[model samples]
Target: MAAIAQERYEDSYLYRLRHSAAHLMAQALTELYPGIKLAIGPPIENGFYYDVDSPVVIREEDLAKIEARMKELSKLDQRIVRMEAPDREAAKKLILEETTLGQGPEVAEYKLLLLEAVPDGETISFYDQQRTDREGKFHRFLDLCRGPHVDSTKEIKHFKLMNLAGAYWRGDAKNKQLTRIYGTAFETKEELETHLHNLEEARKRDHRILGRELGLFMFSPRVGPGLPLWLPKGAVLRDTMVTFLKEEQLKRGYEPVVTPSIASIKLYEKSGHIIAYRDKMFPFMEDEERETYILKPMNCPFHIEIYASQMRSYRDLPVRYAEFGTVHRYEQSGEVTGILRARGFTQDDAHLFVTKDQLIDEFIGVVDLMKTVLDKLGLKDFRARVGTKDPLSDKYVGHDENWVAATEAIEKACQTMGVDYFVSPGDAAFYGPKLDLIIKDALGRDWQMGTVQVDYNLPERFELEYIGEDSKPHRPIMIHRAPFGSLERMIGLLTEQYAGAFPLWLAPVQIAILPIADRHAEYAAELKVRFRDEFKLRVHLDDRRETLGKKIRDTQMQKVPYMVIIGDRDIEQGTVGVRSREEGDLGAMSLDAFIERVKSEL
Candidate 1:
């Protein structure tokens, strides 16, 4: 069902509208900035972007001017017509002549390069937006694009020019950088307004900003760009999440294990990562003995070595090893964004070695665990993506038969679990097929979260075997599952999902005790200790010399779930004033009663 929905989106009218919007924007750019070199422009998931090497600098302030021009062009009712070239030479001639609009051939640099990249015997096409004015004047904007655009630019009335970004031509760092203009279009004005509204909300909920405001984490240039140093409160948040997952794993029969941060390079070579994942790995390190080592990019290879160390019978077939293993990757500086795409992070990684007959049940169990994790994290809107190997790609390591079997196993598990899933080709890991959880947050933005993979190639490569019912050794299949994906990323998403106001059970500081005056400081400290020792809740005591209103305001700003007020009346009456983060102040309640309320929430 999800796969069909995704297909519908690809062929939807909104897709064509956005495609035409890109062309309209390109036309506006050319008219506004003559002799600019145009590159590729395509419709994306949310909008469209056009890459151009402009003669003049393009900045955010220039977006309104470009948008005004687009409006004029859109109202002109230009008919967008598609034309095909007879051959590559004819395509180049059309580009240099029609596309450049009398500008020198130098302006068609990127277009000619795009033409050369097209494979032989494929149709080369262009979309030409042409109009004839009532005053007997003619105008046309021709672009090298394989487009399925709307008939007329008049339909692209509801659109907005978003912003500007620097993108390297063809995404290569070594290539010349070009200005990328991003814009969005919609079928209705209401949708465009709502999208813009959401963009504002997203800016407020950005995790990087919230992390610092909430004292969760920070990044220092001395350490690096993609590495985060967890603050005190942030460490508590991480520990809380780790405890929850560890307890759940124990209940599900997962044993804990630990691994080193670095390993011999030969391990990755055996796992086929050296060939497939080398680009993401850091530079190789060598010791005095000349043996090469690498910062581990993944934990599966380490777990495999532990499994291969022992020879076992059918009883120990399904061996599960769980680890909160830290791994490193070499993300491009531009691609790193806060903790979401950190260079070094810990994965809640686990691997299950099971017999072929036990594969289905084990896979189903892994999926169930993932569901429980999402539910606990307050992420309810989600769908599964079954990532399978692209048939045309040579990067995969497994045989055709193994790939089919692995892919089939995942689909079967999803069906059994009644999971709504879509099949996405070319999204799979090099060795196997997997199911990824795509979580939709409060802002309606999708995040790829927990994942489960079924692999037969790794066990085959490592020769992992177990004795079967027939008393013969048989290769076992491996299941890789990570519920939280990574601690840093999950926390980042949660920080944004709840806008830093975490639930009572998940918040680093569950309650704050705010004393009205210095005279009440001793009582506030006592309550804090009681909350921490008896109720086992995280609590903070604000005994600083401040007014009651200021103390309450400061505690509220921290977004604590509950605040206990200490004053003369409460101290004498053996009661506490309670304030809720969402609701206003509750007049007064017994300390035991408040503890019960917090327990119920947990």
Candidate 2:
């Protein structure tokens, strides 16, 4: 976790404030709805939420009444206290008697089940809120929970009840559905206001909305959820990215190879992915020959098969294979958030097989390539994370010595690159340790954009070998890397980062030529051809017979990087009125001069 996020979780009082806020909301809901049964309430990222089962439906408008009631309750200065029970029976009694609030033992159904799930030796704790009113009437609210709550409810003043949704109990589909109320609390009013404002801006900049509006990409109901169909503009964006990365890979001496989209199930079994990554994989397919095949969820296994195709000598020890392979994973429908978390996406995948002696340099080379890619993409605000083996996790499948060596290789690579990174345990791939680049987007949200993993297990699993100079068979280290991660995901991030107004070189339609009148249409058409054929620029010509003003408006809305206006004044002098998306109109310039300007940007 980053420092600010870590502090917010462990050190800052906001966590306690948010936790207390959840309890406060629960108390208000209990008072408002007689038959409501509380399940669990916990503080989450940016806010807190409570899940409850209510006999009466709570509409969106009903939230105001609930918030009003919460405000009235907070001012009561209710003292929040935590109490622990000695045994399971004592916890059940507390839940049945006090936590139910005279609504009956049936209301304590979820809490009782929660208590049963707790281990035998663990302490059963509950939070109680009580206050004495002016009439001297004692009022209290209690819930069966393990909590460290704020001393009083007054501290939860700056908070808002954000929204409500239906969530299954414990996230199990078979479990009964409950009403989930989400809210955020802040120490100061300013912070809460700022968060709300940013949320509004985020909604505007949401990639799904902008993706379609900007004619970049779209999701179809017929195509099913999480499957995106790239439109013309979107395809152009993908091609531009591919061209750039392909050239970079070629420069780095990576051999391009194409692999099948579906492979035999045995491939994954040999790679240990069937056991470790079955959940993320699509359903297996059985062919006529009784062979089980699965859609490719990863490209590494295919690359491995290629490397082991032939016996290799020490001179051929370093084999780099690159592929823009499309992978399909079975992401849950609800979990898929547009292209960001899609069921199918392309990976800028590659694997470098090298001798153990070349591991450090190969790792460093991969890291350097990643840095170069990030720099070109203008994603500078990123942090490196060295994902090491978790001491507690048995999920990792590599030998202890191999894990240690691979982990050390990644850390040393980062050190030699002079890039600071934090060690994150359990973030490693099951096969080995990795270096993940977490980039902060324009919205200040962190996205895992790229990764480079040092793997020893996969090579061993495949029994891959190469002849060393000493004439002995030896194992090779594998450096798996993808600087872009995926075309869909990276494009999604870039769309939001630039608000669809991509930089000049990246813009799908680099320039739009608009003719002022019917007489100038030929000139505009000629210019478009010149820009496309001669200069290799993505250009669009507006000859739709629309008014000049309307044409300019449409062009700007499309977020074209540049515009050339041709009219009688420009036609006679052989000059074009040039306008840039960023600088607006740049007066009039000759065609030769315009070409030079465009060359500077490219």
TM-scores of the candidates in the order shown:
0.94, 0.94
Q: What does candidate 2's lDDT look like per residue over 294-318, in tens digits?
A: 9999999999999999998889968
lDDT of 1: 0.91
Which stretch of 10 consecutive residues in model 2 shows the poorest summed lDDT? Answer: 1-10
**Runs in model 1 with CA error above 4 Å?**
1-4, 8-10, 102-106, 116-122, 172-176, 392-402
Taking the tens digit of each residue's C-alpha lDDT, what string does model 1 give over 1-602? Answer: 32434766668899999999999999999999999899989999999999999999998999999999999999999999999997898999899889888889999999999999999888899999999999989889998888899999999999999988999999999999999999999999999999999999989889999999999999999999899999999999999999999999999899999999999989998997898789999999999999999999999999999998988788987899999999999999879999999999999999999987788789888988888888899899889999999989998876788788778778878888777899999989887899999999998899998999888788988888988889999999899999999999999999999989999888999999988888888988888888899889999998888888898888877899999998999999889999999888987999889888889989
- Indicate the TM-score of model 1: 0.94
What is the lDDT of every predicted structure here?
0.91, 0.89
Worst 10 residues of 1 by lDDT: 1-10
Q: Report each candidate's C-alpha RMSD, comma-separated, in the order given.
A: 2.3, 2.4
Question: Which regions of candidate 2 fall more than 4 Å away from where they truly are?
Answer: 1-12, 134-137, 286-288
